[model samples]
Target: MVASSSPANIDKSIPSNEYLLEMNIKKVKNILIANRDDRFESLKMIDDIQGLGIDLHFQHEIDQTLDMIYKECSQFYRYYGRDPHEAALCFRLLRQEGHSVQESFFGNILDKEGKFEDNLQNDVKGLVELYEASELGVEGEETLDSVRKFTFNRLIELCSGRESHQEREIMTSLMQPRHKTSRRLTSKRFITMIKIAGQEDEWLQSLLRVAEIDSIMLKSLIQEEMTRTFKWWTELGLEKELLKARNQPLKWYTWSMEILQDPTLSEQRLDLTKTISLIYVIDDIFDVYGELEELAIFTQVIERWDLERLEKLPRYMKVCFEALKMITTEISMKVCKSHGWDPTDSLRKSWASLFKAFLVEAKWFTSGYLPDTEEYMKNGVVSSGVHLVMLHVYFLLGKELTRDKVKLIESNPMLVYY
Candidate 1:
């Protein structure tokens, strides 16, 4: 039997269009004004310029093409303020032709205000005609679709204002995935298998889809059922022995996944609440206790969104982010329902704290010196403490506390296992 392909294999096929555009744009800046004869050679030197899956039969080098495109875009905007089509066209052309311009140029035009402008539409139409003539395949469809969905979702939130907890409950029920046969899989072992299988077959695509769906459904269930139960349980200190066991890396991964996949646990509020709590604990372990190389791998995976990076992550960190993404998405949805709250703010704070902790540990790791345990403790405390304060501020402003309270609990010296 053929083994399934991993995220790393699928990742290798995905184009880094954004990075490519940036490189081309830099080259354009240096060579755009050079003699037109030299321009063709310069353009030819750009790797995958024609293979970018876009049509570009028009003159290879527009004299002052970069400046002219910018000027035309500005004129279109002035004539019809906030038109996205024209701006998108400008970006499309530059990107198609291998220019490294700002994505914001196009992104701003697609913004709510820019989408309404008449001239923008005219420019977009013109550009589309040009693209069709040149046979440039759809270059930005996925990105544009994602952006549009986000914008529309934001607008819906604005119109709906704060939804009642009851309303969220209803929404969660509608979004819940139908339960399938439960697979008793260890996350660590599962990750290893996926990595190995993925190398042999195209497994990453299915894995990504399943993981995303599972995360969303699991987060919803956690928020709906377990939040309050876990909160009270923690407050009562009822699970000292269980909590101790839960603190172990392998055990924590298993329990968390169990809670997410539990058939009986189906409420978004409880699910989200539990997820938040778990995220706090896991974030602490990876951020404060994990080795420097492990943390660095985590950082790179999150920043680059690369499956290869994900594969390189310590098995534990991979499990953590997959879990984190689910919980964070649920919290973000709730925040969107509330209006005006940035659900991601808390997640960002957590990431920043982790980043700081990584840096300090990295210094120690590089120098081959063991950091003073006291100093490491102090650093962890300060970083995590700041994150908690920010989280509290959001909660105070009416954001649901999706994160666990253990983050607020003082550190016990005995718990320091690193």
Candidate 2:
């Protein structure tokens, strides 16, 4: 593809349609050439085309533009195989031009491939600089910075090829003071806006969606950290206090209350609720939601072995024990009583399947045996306390959920992470 003529070569007086057609072709070509080096020039070309009043027809334009961009993007992936900077830029431009398709497209691409290499950190840094310069009016520079830090950390994971350490860093970062504060602020603003309007506004809905996605991601990271931490405990033969609140039940409850009462946490009530709900859901699955055989195995594992003595548990076996117990007992009791169940038979069976799955997972962990990926994934579906928690929340919140929704949640690959 031939690069477009420089900005100096455009004929200013042509009819808008013809000008747009010519500009489109030139822009595509220019972007392709500049794909290797010089992203700014390509962005400029796109901006010019956008200014031309070309209605490539909104949906058609979005589709064609993404196709062309990805075609060029594919070259970078084909050669270097994973340049997140280029990918991030590509998506940012698509969003700037009001093309949601490209944004979704790039998210899928990044989600599937993980992150770019560490040597290309400069590429990511440059992209951040460009994004800051653009001033898109997104809230919270610190939140964006957290995202950038996360992206870089993921890149490091990709480079090292062992994700445990990088995953730990991601968990720590998510719980960082600045990130949590920003999340709380954004959540409060959103809820307040909705309350005053008495309806869900588009912007608020979008913010909630973003928050949900972020929360889900953080939970996944936390799960990973739990696994790694468990491994460390087992390897070192150290009985460390794993849960944030350990001994005093009243103290734990008080601490939880304090966390909730904090202005930052209050602001992010929705997200915090979801996260806590997820923890409880996971706990219920392991303790009460699963089947008899599964529960038996889980009990056997936890009771038989000193967690600190095992060398390496299978990946699925690494859940936080206290978290599992606390969340399960709390949420299941609430859900059962609320639903008017007798709490013995009805409530007990409600969590039977989940418990069984957790037990199986614990057995695998204590045995230090890794199952096949497919088995791991299957077990994950049954074991995910968080998934059940979300389901309960959806039901309680009066949100619509179909079989399709359940499938989508089940299909998430991270479910395999236990």
Candidate 3:
């Protein structure tokens, strides 16, 4: 039923691009580079750059700048180190920049008894930084475990203090540190926080403007990438082939964004999203549609990993296999050209491993086998498709993988539980 158009329902056209201002990326890079010498200033700039969610664009610049600062001062261990706010900030940023940092730096703020000093509670910024820094701790790190527990309770108490209502940013950080949160949400949240609090430095103000403008453009770029992938999806025609499976290109793209959000990875993101979309169809077949015999053939086809094996797969699965093979080749060719490595072998291995895991579940489900807790848990981890996804992306990125590291990645104990 069509309703009569009213004034309130009047047409509003969406612009092709949201940005009206000139986006000078070079200018932002130059500004950050110009101040690489000032430790406090540079660290603050890095934090804002990250908080604003525009870090990916300036990563190389940030890395070089931090490298200079890291070697020049080891300032992570001195007078600035004595201040909890500065020390925590340095430690967090240093570790984030991929520089090796020791948690021992926190000793500067601790007392002879090895506790975060009582006086440190008065410093809101210090407590917030400590809380955030502590969140990055790995297992078995006693100091970080202790600090996380202490700062969490301490920061919760600060919410009652005057002007504390404005500390929503601190509250959010306590819940999930910047590194772990979605870039899209954190970018907007941090921009709001900084806008309200206001920075006094001219350079910071300029950089902040750049971050805002850049983030807007990046959003538009992602939108375009989504559109392009949708077009690719149409060409692939998964909806026609897999009538029972959910035809969800958009959702797959969103999931990929959560996995790898860098704007520069736009093309890579599209490829990955497309791969996941196909994975969704294939996964649904294994889960619900495919019979045991068909599932076995499909798993074997993946293991064989050849064009000739297409004849062995069932009708709908031929589409899935061909699509997977085509996409893998496309990704492989690009990676080879751009980074000089052949990802085909590794990708095939990952796909074969994933199919084996899927077949295990299919076998279990069909046989009505109720495995014991230990057996179920062991199979369930690999069956989760996480290892397959991680290994595929790792190979796609063209990072060097030593034999030992590859072994570690393939059967990492942490990933099973993680």
Candidate 4:
């Protein structure tokens, strides 16, 4: 249970590891600065930096490099793009940086049949990079679709032939491509793979060191956040009061951290963890603890946002309702102070909708009614608590609060559906 050293403690007196972390960050910056004009090398470096999960430290550099690359090569790349690895890497990296790059660039690798050329199978690195990049395609991009299928089949076939580090990487990518997986999870594996392979390039070695140090420091920060959040959870005494509720403060904290992994988002992560914890408690109330009649009343009281109706509920339900109100109020006040807009109405309506959705399921369970697939999915989406979480996220991030945007979010836009 010994505490890890947090990055916050790295002021004038820094730990040796923290000092090393700083020096290596500078080393990375030097490498990035040196390679600024080399478009292909710059793209690969950015890809490596991101793959190593150290991109946050070099975001500005990465952005500048990508901007330069896109400006210089956008049109040329469309016609005479580099090899598959370079073309695919550039396309993925540029699109990720919000550049309007096209997938047609990949068509260069296609043969006369308008399919990925069979010769790409021999280019394992190209196919791997292309496989990872193909995930960025939107709906109806037939070229990307073909690339995905082609690379997947070839990668799978290639996996059974060799057990090398490269093959392992292919298998890993097949399971979770760069575009689909979180950098935090994938970066550690990449670092370990490079170490296992004994890569000796100064840039690669320095990048790995940065990733290691950053991972340790990031873990420390998250540990501290979790400790602070857990203290808040324990102080509420909800665990003892609502015995049947899932007492999982750490779980909630981890979930929030995963969603908002930026180091600067500590406050947002903590707030989100609290909201998610309360959601679990409320869910347990509706699902496991409360009787049908009590759940009905509870849903009604939540929808009404009525403190007066608390007397009619069980003590556990009251505890949950009060906790919900307190957190909602805290969030609303903070948001109002920061953004000059009170989100109380929007927040309440979201919670009310959630509770109503939960109540629908509670009634269904009580009456043994099986809803049709469409009806069930529609309600299930709301009860999934994703919209509620995203609503809080919108306010917590201090996004521009337009009246129309508020209305759009409250209506549960299509983004929340997916």
Candidate 5:
């Protein structure tokens, strides 16, 4: 056993913070292991893990637990029958885990009139849970829509009468449901809730410790990412070169970070932020700087994706075009290596489509022609740059790529509208 000098048994040192992080993760996993049999408690712990932004560390365990829970409980809704909080919590968690839970799961909470029972109006905890669960509703779920309104209005009324921590928490949830809020932002609130409630359980304490450590580590990593991104931006010199273009790399980085909060997505976040920044820069060129003729030429250049046409472009257009080409190529190279397919042409076409849409808007603006709402929205969807951004995101993080999935993404599906 004393083979410390062996090549394979070299004594390597983990940084103290990293060591601490590993220990905390181990503690949290142990807590999950110990409480694996308690359905309600296990679900609550998973929710806490997610809310605390440490679910990335236990994704497999969380998935296994959810799958097991789904299997063990045949009559899922009836299992948590008569307890609104339990029922709503179960519904929300299962739905979040990609289970096709029915809206009628809350049937016990509904009155004969097919509306939520009046008694639930006064049950603050139940109402709050129901409000959060209702957020997972998709198109045409009348029951969830009604539940949201009922819970929202009751929670609003309840919070209006008090200035307590619980009231603040309720107001925060009412403002943005738990599912919609940023994990990092909500984790702070979750930590505050735990401390205020004086939860003295060992698992809660471990969860809290892990959350605190994670927050610190995440902050450091984000700072590093910001520094690196800023360095790249400065070296790109777009701000100095393209004076009229927006230079909001920090804001762009915020979008990337918030949208992709998992620490493991650092590279993807940077690529996304870079793509977004270019979108803004190119958008500004079209809307603010470029003459209609210049924008038209720029659109054609992008459509062709030929740098040989660079001689015909104006100085500013050339700068923007080169930067766009470079970024697109860099992303394509990375994606091709990982996904085993070149996305270069697809990426170019996406940008070309965006520019064409922008040119349409530019022409309309120049001629003082305001299209009808339908016409404007139809064009606006393309000009929105959502498809462009999402295209890049798909290629960057897409695990599996089928012809159908590629077609769906390229079609600019209804997902981008929302």
Candidate 6:
């Protein structure tokens, strides 16, 4: 096949996509196994593989590596405590994986003056790793907060007129800061950089091949998964119902893939993507298609969640409402059967909450009733629809459902930022 132009580089290794995937997986395993005993290097390789964004293909390997490293952390504790770079990588990776590695793990590297040593600033990799790691801090982490500021400014100063590979790495870390960067976007850039750098190391060549093949494998899988949604939407007759609604299934899939990229989360991705497509239709129903009176009836039918009541909805609203009901039930039943938990009530409630928010915005749109920023923001939290999305997702994740967590979701805390 011919490679397309525009940021295109043809990878002709392994002859077929299937062989590339097989060879890449085996190659990645060998690379890790070769450095298995070196905790810092193993973790660094894992980080680079993930940062370069072929992590999905290696979940089992990554998990085993991390688990081993976690055990090794307990056994060979001094290496991390003695080295700033290793300490940052370990602390960041462990904490990111939900281990409670304290922010104070840097204490061993700090001088008596209670500051990170000025000499450490000259250690480009350490400073860059520390800067990237600092992005994982929570609210009120004063030490990490200071470290973030320090490392960020230090890297900026360190980058002036510097053109080394580590310099480029530092600049990349400072600019994108990993947590804010998408895996796909980061992977593309990292892959391109790896290619351009003319890496001569056999290990790096293997890493590059793994990155390329795994990326192709995932792109194919993601495309295949998204095709199912396209078929479902077509058969569901949403396009006929919400005629002017944005009809971009691919866009919705891309957004969902951003968060749920694991191939195993195919169920969640489809469910969430389907929900997003429905919301796109519903949003248009509220914003453009439905009259105020019909919208009120439609919202009430959703609130009641009664099929008979859906009959009372305007004809345009009927298909949308039925589709919503069917998808919601399907999701709930899947949970009920597989997880042995009845989630229909919770799922229904979340839908009701989302529909109510839709109605609120619909009223505002029709009446031209403009609220002040505070009121707009308060309503926007729900109307933004992230909470409802997350509520359904929380259930989809199969976590033990609790009233307290449900109540917290209802409070619209993290979702307010949307």
Best by lDDT: 4
Clashes of each: 32, 21, 0, 0, 0, 0
TM-score of each: 0.29, 0.31, 0.81, 0.88, 0.90, 0.78
State the C-alpha lDDT per candidate. Answer: 0.44, 0.42, 0.76, 0.85, 0.85, 0.77
The CA-based lDDT of model 4 is what? Answer: 0.85
lDDT (tens digit, per residue) of candidate 6 on 258-292: 86777678888898888888777787888888888
lDDT of 5 by residue, 1-418 (tens): 5546666765566456678878878988987878889999898889888888788889989998888888886568778868889888888998988987888877778878887777777888899899999999998998899889888888888987676977887888888787888787778878987775547777778778778888888889999999999999999888997777788889999989987877888899999999999989988988888888878878888899767766777787887787888999999999989888788878888888899899999999999999999889888888888888888888998677777887778776356876
Q: What's the CA error at residue 103 for candidate 3, in Å?
A: 1.7
Greater lDDT among 2 and 4 belongs to: 4
Compare the candidates by TM-score and give the number of the best one: 5
Of 1 and 2, the candidate ahead on TM-score is: 2
Q: Candidate 2 — worst ten consecutive residues by lDDT sum?
A: 49-58
RMSD of 5: 4.6
Q: Which lDDT value does model 1 have at 363? A: 62
lDDT of 1 at 327: 58
Please give the distance, in angstroms, between residue 199's alpha carbon in candidate 4 and its true position after superposition. 5.0
Q: Write the per-residue lDDT of candidate 4 for residues 106-149, one digit (tens) a residue.
A: 87888778876766778889998888888988898988898899
Quote model 4's TM-score.
0.88
Give candidate 4 regions above 4 Å deviation. Answer: 1-19, 76-80, 196-200, 368-373
Give me candidate 5's TM-score against the actual structure: 0.90
Candidate with the larger lDDT of 4 and 5: 4
Candidate 5 off by > 4 Å: 1-15, 73-75
